[model samples]
Target: MGSATSSRSRASWLALLSAFTAGVGLGFLAHEYREVIVANPGIIGLTLLVVFAAGYLIRLAVRALRRAGSRVDTILAEELEKKPSPRPR
Candidate 1:
């Protein structure tokens, strides 16, 4: 059960990374071929592409920050565990 939980979290991380990478790549392609995309798909397609790319990037950033917060929390917990509590004067 523990291993399964661990694997699930790892898989989610991998998926997030893949999504962020793909978003960046697609966004670059869209920018590069902006005129063609606009011509064929028009305003709607371009808007959707931009929104998805931005949203993915934002999600990646937020995930990274959350991970960092958890790490910091774990470190603090460990330190608290190691230290003795103060006594009344």
Candidate 2:
């Protein structure tokens, strides 16, 4: 369980890092293609719209994971409650 928690934490960190990297790369690419992007405002606007959607999805997924984690904790606590208590010495 400790390992599982650690893995999840690592995965979450990696995801955040990946998102940041992607955003940086995209920004650089946009800047490099500034002239073309400006000439075709529709294309640039569409691309940005897609990026915004991806960001929204990422936020939704993170929120869902947090909510699920709390539910898992509640379930684990309930299961532990059903176990017999240790006998007195």
Question: What lDDT tens digits, residue by residue, belong to model 1 across residues 1-89?
Answer: 89979998999999999989998998999899988887787676778899989989998999999899999999999999998769765
TM-score of predicted model 2? Answer: 0.64
Using all chains and alpha carbons, the TM-scores for the candidates as numbered come to 0.49, 0.64
lDDT of 1: 0.91
lDDT agreement of model 2 with the native: 0.93
How far residue 63's Cα lies from its native spot in candidate 2, in Å, is: 0.7
Steric overlap count per candidate = 0, 0
State in Å the error of residue 34, model 1: 22
For residue 83, give model 1's deviation from the true position in Å.
1.5
Worst 10 residues of 2 by lDDT: 80-89
- Model 1 stretches with alpha carbons more than 4 Å out: 1-40
